[model samples]
Target: MIGMSLLVRLALLLPPNVPQIPVLCYHQIRDWRPKDRTADKAYIMPPATFRLHMKMLADSGYHAILPDELYAHLTKGTPLPSKPVMLTFDDTDGDQYSIARPEMAKYGFKGVYFIVFNNINKNKYYMSRAQIRQLSDEGHVIACHTLTHPNIRKLKGSDWAAELDVPARKLELLTGKPVRYFAYPFGIWDQQILPELSRYGYLAAFQLDEPRDSAKPLLTVRRVIDDGRWDTSTLDRYLKHGFGHK
Candidate 1:
């Protein structure tokens, strides 16, 4: 595992001749609380900062693509836009409907949201089922996160089945379109589940960091977490620096 991890890190160092599409992973697009000052603030991407990101992308000619488009590019050798990017929001937070959608629309962009089916419409923090459907109706891709957002690696048998299959079934019923992609809960994954993912008819799956398998693309694809610290200039530097850990 250590050797594989090292190989993946080294592989990411080489510059890609093709356009290296960045799948930006975000959680909350809302204000940070004073109590969360000492806590992990990466999940809370401030609305103004998010606006700056959208503005920067728009100004720089970056266009967001759906997750399925990303899958097609990776698997079928399909061509993508000159400056392809994918904006993926995990956990289907209510602020996504309330804040991020409007902010993205300002740049005429659509993002993919991975929803937790069990939490939908059940709490103030989560987007309701109707709101998720509305996003789908408006062209945002609605994908499955899981039923209860449990770490799949820790689950087995029926527990694993419920985690992987149930939400996907419900999502398909909600969207009317096939649920083509998935994002791992907490960015946790096991390659053993890849076969099951294929069985579920998922084109690809995403994780928070670079994937271990570059030989076979898009099973557990890489994504960069858009924490609150990013601004336009810093982001340019980060991408220019091979998106490697600084």
Candidate 2:
């Protein structure tokens, strides 16, 4: 473990010219309802729109890569597929399993599911433990979101264990694999927490649209949220803008 940590520290010092890979963060994958707030609709993707996004990606030859491939590419200077993109779901919504999974499967794509551990089997709208485990078994990466989706910037002391360590252990048990990646709740993080994340054995952590920490780029890996309102053309533009290619 010490040697691995030393390797990571050495890798962290490398120039950040690693190929630009677009990582899309998604939330609920269901259609909007009458009760849905206007602001909340940004995160609630309708089924048809979601399908179109997948179709576009597939048609455009975008290969969905998982966390391990991404880590290797960034740290060890490994080569990626012709058009590598990462589809990451946050918050463990039930629709991600019921809807997003099959849609991605059609394109022979896999995704990273960042789970809120406390919500499993407890919240009606969230995914159950069985569903999460199945995703992991099916080769999709199961990563940590947090215990309760709290803003990580406010956490202190044992709060870190509750949010990071405990949940990560629970997820590993459920998935029968190590949880080595994390997505910050509400895409918020602090520099002080980067070392804490490393101490907890995370290889990397993701945040939404934030400039990466120059010295610790792995911990602050950036992602862009796939808004519910986007059309196929909008997705194409954003992909090009974010990754410098279509």
Candidate 3:
């Protein structure tokens, strides 16, 4: 499946003119991060706030597309709405399975979750296999972020492939489904790494960098890192650019 996909993408590469889609990256979904913990502040958000954001998208007439829609938009020249929002989560944090889903459910929206194999809930913060399986069955696209969430820009050869293949195989074996997406940890990427990325069978890849051209996008695309630091104001900036920046 992966080899064919790489060939297809390479065969399609040409002069640009594709419309951009916005993908929003999020971490933890907490009502409030305890002020005492510096890490918690960056990793958490109030549940009510997330609800508001989803409502904002719906109320503003935005449509959230699934992985396939994104694929179509890029590869088939499919058209999407003016405000197409993609909600994505990094790490298989348990709160997202239990808390975030319910909040997003209010708006009838879903997101793609990137899970790190090594961090599957050894601590109080991570998610368990059951929770991960349940969430995957509930319609969210469970994606890979490598085992242990290593920075791939520094990895070489088969070592890098294992980082990706481990979770992809694990998730697929557990879910009995194909794991098709991958999110690069910390938005770090090396363009040279893309060929291997394709070799691994990922249908699409995401990062923190926006595509240089909207028309002819690489399978690996950039998303806006959404957090409490910037409210709807930051999203508005992406909207203005006529690109799916967030």
In terms of lDDT, which candidate is strongest?
2
TM-score ranking, high to low = 2, 1, 3
The sequence of per-residue lDDT tens digits that candidate 1 reaches over residues 1-246 is: 012233333332333332356778889888888888734577789899988988988888888898767655654568888677889999989998899999899888999999999889888999998999999999999998989988787877787668777888899899897776788999987767776776566666788775445433456667888778777888766555644321
Ranking by lDDT: 2, 1, 3
How well does each candidate superpose onto the true structure, as a TM-score?
0.87, 0.94, 0.86
Question: What's the lDDT of the predicted structure labeled candidate 3?
Answer: 0.73
Name model 3 segments beyond 4 Å from true: 5-7, 11-17, 31-43, 210-216, 242-246
Candidate with the greatest TM-score versus the true structure: 2
TM-score of 2: 0.94
Which pairs of residues clash in candidate 1, taking residues 3 or more apart in a chain or in different chains? none
RMSD of each: 6.2, 2.1, 3.0
Instruction: Give the poorly placed runs of model 2, Cα more than 4 Å off.
Output: 1-4, 244-246
What does candidate 1 score on TM?
0.87
lDDT of 1 at 57: 84
What is the C-alpha lDDT profile of model 3 across 152-187, one tens digit per residue?
Answer: 877887787689887799989877778888888887
Tell me the spans in candidate 1 whose CA falls farther than 4 Å from its real position. 1-20, 37-39, 243-246
* CA shift of 185, model 2, Å: 0.3
